[model samples]
Target: MRLHLRLILTVLLAGFAALVAAGPAAAHVVPSTVLQLDVHEDDITVEMTLPTTDLVTASGIDVPVDGTVPAAAAEQLAAYVEEHFDVTIAAASDATSATGTWNVDVGDVATAEVEQWGTGAFDAVTATATLTPPAGADLRSFTLDYDAILHQVVTADVFVLLRSDSSTGEVEQTRSLGAITLDTVTGTVSPLTVDLAGGSARQGFTGMLLLGISHIAEGTDHQLFLLTLLLPAPLLAASLAGDRAGRSRHWREVAPTRRAVRRITTTTIAFTIGHSLTLALGALGLPVPQQPVEAAIAVSILIAAAHAVRPLFPGREPLIAALFGLVHGMAFSTTLSEMELSGTQLVLSLLGFNLGIELMQLVVVLLVLPPLIVLARTPAYRPLRTTAAVVTAVAAVGWLLDRVGVPTPLSTAADSLGSVSPWIAATLWIAAALVLLGTRGRRSGIRRVVSA
Candidate 1:
């Protein structure tokens, strides 16, 4: 009896030590599955990412040596995921009604190696699926019965994220819904009940407004294009001597303050109209070829810079600004097109985004134009304008070359110009102030000499 008791105690002590040793490893284990959901008008899109090693273990699908999912394995993986994943509602109409199951169509299986924290590097399988609720059923409040890998690998976890829901005012943002893990106490996996509340139109509009503000604020090329066009707003165009039919012209004198302000206003308004028209059409359904539009924008800036040095269109700056604004508008529409919003949300977003853009444009004009007008009155303005135009032309050429797939150091340096723009604006203001002070001192000295 004594020997038996000693043996039992020894075994119990060894088991406790093993449990203590395994605790750290279990704690350090990273989640193996991720589900990103995008809620649209009529359906939800699910992007599932799973570890390839665990996926093979759970679904018995073959993983190729090169880490790409083979044709046969891709089909098998899709079918296995379809079998394991489901979405349903607890009640169709009322609390006591029967549960309604959502239809899920899975496809687009792809494989790649991904890195995860605490798990090091591992091969991952990604698949896309569309989840559609039954006719007349609520999509926001549904039960997600997903068990792709966790159904077999009991220790695995699946993280669910709401990637974008236009109605909820979420665009290009990720929100964590919850995680799906086995309940150790019950020894079973439960469905995650997603209850997304109804979102207001105001919320969506505000989100789009902020998005538009940031878009303009961060878009250095766009800022350069607009500012470069406005560089000669205060200068007057005059015909060159010995030129027949008045074809050749140059920026020879400063315009009246009233005339300059009016010209700036007209050009800015024309640009707004041009971009707004294309932005609406493009967001509605028009296809915009992104590359050409971008390259054309760079070309617009180059033309503007050249015109700043020597009047190209002369008095027709508004028309030119409007024409180039059409190209810029198409670029702006790319942001909204990716959101996939529809109906009232789309309308509000359009208004909010345009308003945000105009607000920023107004702020920029207010900050930069006053100093430019003051500097334009000074004799030093000639060299200042020419130097600025030359630098702008160089940057525009760099962007044009880079956008066309020819990368160069000039493009990188041009991009860095946005970071130091504040300093440039300050210098312009200081120069204008000094020129004004010097002019006042000269006038005072002349008055004193005449009096003497």
Candidate 2:
């Protein structure tokens, strides 16, 4: 019991330590801004409204020219805008235009011409162009490039909005500034194909892999589930008696580690397969009920948590993991469904997204595995194990209830765990090391007493 308790403490400490070291890479959202796009038969129109707050945050450019600034500062700001805001239109055929690229014919665009349209607000700046297609030109397909904010502010995302109005109502389309391969020195925008139409099969597979790995890494629920499953492993070994304890020890001791790796691997793979299946099914136009799928995931987690406390089915964790994984996978498909991928681009996105997910998962697993295995061998593993397990079970139950249409503090508390992962990890490491050293000292003292 003593040894088991020590082991539990060690694993917990290690788990916590890893969580702390993960840093701010976990909570960041992808850089996305809303842009509405509209297309017409004769021409295309783009209107961009920059949010001052987001612009300031992303780039140091503080818009809405402060009247408080000196003349030099104001002049510098104007110059920056003049140099940065630009629009370029490329013709499909070189014969259509002399240079093949047409700049918005606003002659001698100057810093002084850029005016402040509103007070203390990021207002709309509109640039319009009407082009007549060549005698045998393709109007449906042409290159439209805008480097308005891309030059001075490379990191800042520019979203282009287009709206078309005819005899009927207005139709709108929006697209993010796709991969703009910029020449650092020349400040030229190189065109790269944006796979909005969803790429080939190979691409889709890669994207799915990335998406899967990412989902797991950022998934607090998944991490919590793994932690809970591992929480009682070390303690289970010390609970056995004498040689039976040792014999039970060999199996039980090895059981958690083997099972843990297996469970994680199985769950992860199953989750990938399950989600991929659903993603394909959903993406391929299968009608799936969303609410029920979500509810199913919550129920699955609750079941897994309950099973973790006391084996719902002994020696069958992997099977249970695979089953629960399927539910989790279905839940994951929700993100891909919104992407609206078609043809080759869809395939590429699926592949790229999935690859990203796998990379993150592999990193997380490698970071977490070592300390977990080390702690399982220590004496003080059991009590701590049970405590962690109990806590996990409670949280899972809360999630279950919440999923079933009841809101509670338990769910909120569980959700907030990621925020404190760093602190929790640090405390665990310190506590586990201290306990291990203390246990070693106590063992040394016991030997001296016996010899004396």
Candidate 3:
């Protein structure tokens, strides 16, 4: 009896130790299968990111020697997933009542790695499972009966992410409806009936607005180009404004506050108009060559940077801004036109998106302009301008090379520069304050010396 009791205790202790060790091993275990659902007007795009081992186990496919899934295995996997996955879409009025056989087609299958989870460390396969309902069927409100991985591995969970549902206001941002995991006791997988509520047009418009704001914020080259052009605004163009007496040209002392403000405002407005027109036209069936537009934007930055170092365009900053703004507009157009928007949706999205871009541009201008205006009067302004122009030129050259097919770290660093924007803003404010204080102290000292 004592020996039996000791054996039982030994077993329990071993199990307890194993459970304790599993706490760290949790990461190694597959978390859950993710199905990214992107909803469009006519159809729904389902992106499945499934673990390789789990897929092989679930589909019962033979692994090839090269560790890559063979054609036969891939087809088998797709067939198994399709058998377990389905979506039932109905008309807006009969969404709850209408129930008939719906056709769900699994599109091209592609193997993908979960790069973020771990690369060369973990394996995942991605496939596009599209469901195109009948012409009049509503995409916004539908029932999704997806039982992909959970069908086989009862404990396995499936995360359903609303990637880009125009009707539900899920664009670049994602909102989780819930997970599709089995009830361990009941051993049942339930349907994820997604009845996304709200106006598609409104959702699309707002989504595009937020996207535009994010796009402008991330496109460092665009902001850099604009800021560099504005660098020389406060300086007098002197002989470089038109014709010199054939003597060496130079930027004169800072211009009046009103003149500087006027120049900045004009430049900002020209850029807005330039980009807005192209953004609208591009969405309204304008064919924009993406590659050339990207390259041109980089070139625009380089040109602006050079202009700052030496008065290339002089007082014609707004003209240059407008011309390059056309290129930037084309770049911006790519963001909207890719959605394949049309009619009222297209028009509203275009308006809302441009409004967002303008709003952000204005905010950035307001944040950076005051410092530039304050510093222009200082003797250090010329050197400051030269340094900023040089840095911008370097970043532009990096981006130009990258867009033209040559990759470098400078572009990456420049792109990441946005992460430190808060620090930059803080530094600028502190510098402006110090400049004001120094100037006041100098004036007081001069008065005292004169009185003595």
Candidate number achieving the greatest lDDT relative to the actual structure? 1
Q: In candidate 3, what are the lDDT values of residues 1-452, reduced to their tens digit?
A: 23322433344344323432332112444546888877766677887877767766777776442345678777887788889887776345374554554567775666655643433335677778887765556666677777776767776778888877655335667778788778788878877777676766777778778878887787777778877877888887666555557244567768898998899899999998899989888987799988888889989999999988777776788888888888899889876765666677777788888988888888888888888788777766676677668777877887888889998776676665565555555655666777788789999999999999
* Candidate 1 residue spans exceeding 4 A from truth: 1-35, 47-74, 90-98, 108-127, 143-160, 175-195, 239-241, 245-249, 407-417, 441-452
| Ranking of candidates on TM-score, top first | 3, 1, 2
| Each model's lDDT | 0.80, 0.50, 0.74
- Candidate 1: the clashing residue pairs are none
Model 2 accuracy (lDDT, Cα): 0.50
List ranges where model 3 is wrong by over 4 Å.
1-32, 60-80, 89-97, 117-123, 134-138, 153-157, 182-187, 200-204, 238-249, 285-291, 444-452
User: By TM-score, is 2 or 3 better?
Assistant: 3
Candidate RMSDs in Å, in order, are 16.8, 13.5, 13.9
Sorted by lDDT (best first), the order is 1, 3, 2
Clashes of 3: 0
Please report how far candidate 1 places residue 31 from its true position, in Å: 11
